[model samples]
Target: MTDWQVHALKYADRNSRTRAESFIFDDNHDAPHAMDYFIWVLRRGAEVILVDCGYDSEEATRRGRPILRDPRDALAGIGLKAEDITQLIVTHLHYDHAGGLHLFPNATIHLQEAEMAYATGPCMCHDTLKMPFTADHVCEAVKRVFQGRCVFHDGDAEVSEGVTVHCLGGHSRGLQAVRVRTEAGWLCLASDATHFYENVFENKPFPIVVDLQNMLDGFARLHELASDRSLIIPGHDPLVTTLFPQDGPEFCWRLDRGPSGDFNL
Candidate 1:
């Protein structure tokens, strides 16, 4: 069985459109750009797991996000479709991370139960909490539960042979990151738990975080779990392609191999 295969299913990128200071550190005047969201396909034998669904282009435009490419197009390049997806791990219920849920019909979704509550609960009124999510998407996930496709977990849990999910409540309640053992080595998808590598390296929590303490704690936990810090990939870091190898043409991306020992700067 091949270990793990990941693709950059980017739905959007910050291409000189909007300046977001919220994603950067307090001391730095630099603009830290980001990729919206996409699926991480982990395959060992016939089992396949998808981490996060990229949002639709229309909504992204409505929100004034710069659309780089369509996520579905990225999936097609890998010969996959929504129904072909076996399982999905939602890092959080923010629209960018979970909006395309309508695309995957046959996959059982793994999500933090606390995340579901927070997205739908009254806590969204707080400025720090409400800005990152879309209530409509949370409502859809709730509906999927009745359809027997949602698997809710409170904390850490194993979804398959090599994938582990750690529920970290900070960027959003129930937001989790995935750690997978691959032939290359251990890879941890920081998801939205930490938007950029600088957020972890500098201990700076992204501005939209709900619980500041949880966000900081989550960063520490990521460090503890990484086989090597380099394998820990941030959710929105623009430098991911440069840090790792390129698989195709100038724009395409690829995953790299390493141990759980050191962080890749």
Candidate 2:
């Protein structure tokens, strides 16, 4: 199998009060949750595949989420420039995950067909379901489709050698997760399917779910896809930085290698 280097770039983080009842579907009192924002990069030889374009500083300010640094700058820290990337996988159309679409001008954006429909379809007519998406970001994706830069996948599809995307509608109507073959083994990048390790480990669903059953099932699918529990990476957990060894001073962690320390499974 062809192996690739996986890197997680953390762009911003926020601390919020969350209860186990809200996040886990179980009754538990208040707990502090660290919501970290990140974009992933996969590299093999000279090929680069980016996953989830992180939101820009303006969106951060408007949303009241402080920016640690621009996601583009975070990519630069790992020796990559936005324009140089030719392929990107969009987990979903949420503003924080897809807002930076304009940054990668020349890249082919891969997304789930259902996601595009969900973002532009009747569900968006309600403000509650549309809160996570920025109109401009969704509109730009439509433009990309017209420009021949968007590739919509019906379900599971291979992005490159050893890298595959699986559509698992849970948090959104078309959310997907990426599985990549790494030096360690097959690592499942459980994007929003499982926002934190606890979500999967404890069988707790996040509060902002569109389909609760699908979200629970997605967790099972992640376990089935990954080589092992430790190889599965969550979407917005601070423990990712602590468990995985840092590549440098910036928030880059090399996912191709084994985790630096033990974490409760």
Candidate 3:
């Protein structure tokens, strides 16, 4: 397998959120639970594959989540421009995940078939089910579909020789996780499949869930995909940057090098 280097680039943050918003049944719900936004990049020479582009400024305002840096601007930290990305893996259609679909106009999007349907289908009629999604983002994806720029997967499929996406519908109807082969071992980017290490390791599910059972099953699935517990990078955990060695510019962590210190996953 071709070895790839992975970097988790932080772009935005939400510090006011509490544990109740993150975990479904935690006793310490009042405790502060911060979430950091990031867009992951996998590279091997000039080839660049992006995973979940961060939300644009519009989404930040509408959702009350401010951006520390624009997702497009954050790309410069890794010497990449929006036009340079040729492949994108969209974990789900949530506002934070697919909100910048239009930003990567040059890339072919990789998404689960179920995710597209969930975002556009009847399920979105309910406000609770639709809260995390933005209509414009879904429209952008639909436009991409018409433009023949999307590769839809049924469940688990390979995006590249060393990179793959697996459907783990729970947080969102079609939320999936990205797995990549790196020098350190197999590293899995658990995007919303496990928002924090505790969400999986402690058997807690994030509050915004579509299917409770699928969310529960996905925790185990995340562990199964990675070589070690420490290698599993959670989606919104602020600890991810500290867990892995910092690389390139600020807010960027080199996931391919593994953890810099014992995170005690």
Candidate 4:
């Protein structure tokens, strides 16, 4: 059995009004609203895995991102430094999820090859698609690839025992999610495969989705993969803290319980 723990590394928070302008639907004029950027960590045994790397404080400031603190600082609250991480998984290449990668220099990162190609490919000609990414961030990711720290999977691949990555392209071409065996059963991490729980619950696709049909299909797959709805977690929902119990000394909010009664704290 594999044990896991989850930690929230909040890098930024945006007011609802700011994010609503571009994201929320309104019969009236486009009103702006804000959202938050969070990175998560999964720990199993002596191995520490990070789900995403939020933007660095400086990068966020330069980009005019309304942030609360550096993601590294949040990690520090848990007594972990960047180097402490052994593995990193980027569900996709969106800026909010892939920003603070530079902070972890010693990790071997897992990613979908299609995602890397898409982010650096011709599809970027579309402004809507390009808006979610920062060129510098992608470039930095490329550097990591050359440095031999990047691991690209073709489609579905298991990086560890009972931890599997599945292809569920929708919001992005190579968007993927994670499924791990736990004491409670199977837990699926629907990372950006369906941003908020509302998207899946209401069957409303995020307007920014690359393919509407795939988004719907992904939701179905997620439900099938998760033994129970309560075991499924959305990428950016604020409700995770309420649904799971905190288990570590710092920043340890676990997502699932292992066969040995260990949890993803």
Q: What's the CA error at residue 252 for candidate 2, in Å?
A: 0.7
Candidate 4 yields a Cα-based lDDT of 0.75
Clashing pairs in 1: 227-260, 227-261, 228-260, 228-261, 228-262, 229-262, 229-263, 230-263, 230-264
- What TM-score does each of the candidates earn? 0.89, 0.96, 0.98, 0.86
Which candidate number would show the highest TM-score if scored against the true structure? Answer: 3
lDDT of 3 at 46: 71
Candidate 1 lDDT tens digits, 13-72: 664522255443465446544444445666565666788987777767668875566666
On a 0 to 1 TM-score scale, where does candidate 1 land against the true structure?
A: 0.89
**Largest lDDT belongs to which candidate?**
3
CA lDDT of every candidate: 0.75, 0.89, 0.92, 0.75
Question: Per-residue alpha-carbon lDDT of model 4 for 1-265, expressed as tens digits?
Answer: 6656555555666665433333335343355434445677776777777788877767777777756767777788777898898788888888888887778888788999988999999999999988888888888789989999899998899988877898888889888898877666888888887666766765756677787788889989898878877777777765565556665534446666522233232
Tell me the lDDT of model 1 at 4. Answer: 72
Runs in model 2 deviating more than 4 A are 20-22
User: Candidate 2 lDDT, tens digit per residue, 111-182?
Assistant: 999999999999988888999999999998999999999999988999888999999889999999999999
Cα displacement (angstroms), candidate 1, residue 256, comes to 4.9
TM-score rank, highest first? 3, 2, 1, 4
Error at 14, model 3, angstroms: 0.8
**Which segments of candidate 1 are over 4 A away from where they belong?**
17-20, 23-25, 30-37, 249-252, 256-264
**Residue pair clashes in candidate 3:** none
Candidate 3 TM-score, true structure as reference: 0.98
